[model samples]
Target: MAEYRLKTPLSNEDVEKLKSGDIVYLSGTMYTARDAAHKRLVDLILNGEELPFELEGAVIYYVGPTPPKPGEPIGSAGPTTSYRMDPYAPILIEHGLKGMIGKGKRNQDVKDACVKYKAVYFGATGGAAALIAKAIKKAEVIAYPELGPEAVRRIEVEDFPVVVVNDTFGNDLYDEGRKLWEKK
Candidate 1:
């Protein structure tokens, strides 16, 4: 229940202050990637090739936005199911990714990675794509344009809303809520 406004690229201190269930309004830059983009990112890391963007302190949103309407930077940019990227998340986290925005729960490896890496996972509201799109001030395809909507895009956001689903301390909001409900 605490509310915080944070800017990226997030610092370790910034993530350490957060706890699961805290509401966060994030501003500054974030990148977009789905499963395909994530795989490519991991491949680049494994190959010791240059990545399209800097990974240190970076936040990646699990989204593939639809084509924008006139005068808009993006469209219907809701978070996709996060688990799809679970396979590659730990590697990215180990490499310096600091945050993630998506829906649903992440696997144990991802949660553990957060604790080990001082990273955090934020849950964006699903079915609120259009509303979320409003927060994106600018977007540009930075890599893998052939992936189309799944392409990696660099985006700037202003007060983009999210909730801390998993924190650097290995706390999980969904599990906490489940326990609370069971107690009730």
Candidate 2:
């Protein structure tokens, strides 16, 4: 495994260098979206409508953060289970989504999309929401405000931690880990 620090609007080269189980600390801007926002995004794509944000080389985090307390950019920003977004992930990837940050396994179609499109799936530490929030320097809802926490937000992060769960080569960290345990 390798460790890399990457800036957003990731290129094919950026994702190509990664391997499953590699460590990554991402910096720069990324967007937040859960199931609801994902549906809307895919719908816009299918309908040939303009999206709220540019999709090229973008990273999406599957999170619906808690409201900030007294003064903070965001609060308790943990990853949601990835499967919920599987239905729409491939379409997004095909449209130039470069990375995803979430928890748990992804469906085969999503995995295939990553391999075909030079995208990657990243896993954030699920229980470390408070700790993760510290890396988010700024957050603003860019769309779907009525969804509250589910609103799409553009966030700026610095050295935000993640693990490469599925890489462009189609390697899956979760599967590799399971195989290692089976050998034990």
Candidate 3:
């Protein structure tokens, strides 16, 4: 495929076109959630309740942000490790969650869910909070505001750099990339 770059307001089809390792400049309203929020969401799922937002192909950023300063949309924001959310991932996938942005290795079930559901897992650079927050143009807490940093917020971002660490084809860049470099 040709080198493709996407802007905000991308559709599900637009998200679907993304491949592993494709550089992206994301700009749009992306909802933020993390491990605890995910647990609550999954609980609601078991209770046969509706989610706060339509997740079908919607991008989820795995982050719990620091309190934003006055006049700032959000505080420093960045991807947390994906392993913490492992329990609830498949459920999100089954519900049409097309992608998850986080860091570190995801569980096998998460990888399997990607294959079964055509989802992708992107890894934003770890510890790049200041730069990551810059991509967010706006922020609003959508759920669990009392959770403080773990609050679910709707954030709009632009040109957020990420690499596809895990692709739907069952490839893991963290492992594969390391194997290439760690050769004895």
Q: Candidate 3 local accuracy as lDDT?
A: 0.81
In model 1, the runs with Cα more than 4 Å from the true position are: none
How many clashes show up in model 2? 0
- Across 97-147, the per-residue lDDT of candidate 1 in tens digits comes to 999999999999999999998999999999899999999999999999999
Model 2 alpha-carbon drift over 4 Å, by segment: none
38-114 in candidate 2: lDDT tens per residue? 99999999999999999999999999999999889999999999999999999999999999999999999999999
Off by over 4 Å in 3: 1-3, 7-16
Decide which is better by TM-score, 2 or 3.
2
Worst 10 residues of 2 by lDDT: 175-184
Best-to-worst ranking by TM-score: 2, 1, 3
Q: Model 1, poorest ten-residue lDDT window?
A: 175-184
* Candidate 1 TM-score, true structure as reference: 0.97
Cα lDDT tens digits for candidate 3, 73-100: 8888878988999889999888888778
- Each prediction's RMSD over C-alphas, in Å, is 1.1, 0.9, 1.9
Q: Pick the candidate with the highest lDDT.
A: 2
> Ten-residue segment with the worst summed lDDT in candidate 3?
1-10
